[model samples]
Target: MQADITVDTKGMACPMPIVKAKKALDNLEPGQIMEVVSTDKGSVNDFQAWVKQTNHELVHYVEENGVFTFYVKKQ
Candidate 1:
């Protein structure tokens, strides 16, 4: 099963996207997917490390044209 949420954080810098993503994840139920799109390059690595630390599942992530997209599942 798969569920998706999209977060757009353009023009935002470090910690903002990560902060918002964490907040959004709090509202999600287990197994739900959250998709975060950020213009911040730090988000790519930050999100990845966060998921690893938190034990959440990271489905996929990609960056294109300075846009970073992450697909993570709530634990």
Candidate 2:
């Protein structure tokens, strides 16, 4: 899926990925998509919980090699 913004947190650890994602998402308009690429394994659960708590939509996510990619739509 294409995104209005893409945040690459490839080498970041735990909270950093979520933190960067939050900042990127904040700059997007409602219904716009934000794509996050991270190497942090914790991002799986982190993004899930963050989306739930923020009422955003986790449009899709996939893992390739060791990188995780997520598409989130702002609500």
- Give Cα distance to truth, residue 32, candidate 1, Å: 0.4
lDDT tens digits by residue: candidate 1, 2-73: 446787888999889999989999999998999888998866777798999999998888789988888888
Estimate candidate 1's alpha-carbon lDDT, on a 0 to 1 scale.
Answer: 0.86
Best TM-score among the predictions, by candidate number? 2
Q: What is the lDDT of candidate 2?
A: 0.93
Off by over 4 Å in 1: 1-3
Error of 1 at 40 (Å): 0.6
Off by over 4 Å in 2: none
| Tens-digit per-residue lDDT, 1-75, candidate 2 | 878999999999989999999999999999999999999997789789999899999999999999999999999
Q: What lDDT does candidate 2 reach at residue 12?
A: 95
Q: What TM-score goes with each of the models?
A: 0.90, 0.96
Ten-residue stretch with the least lDDT total in model 1: 1-10
The RMSD (Cα, Å) of candidate 1 is: 1.8
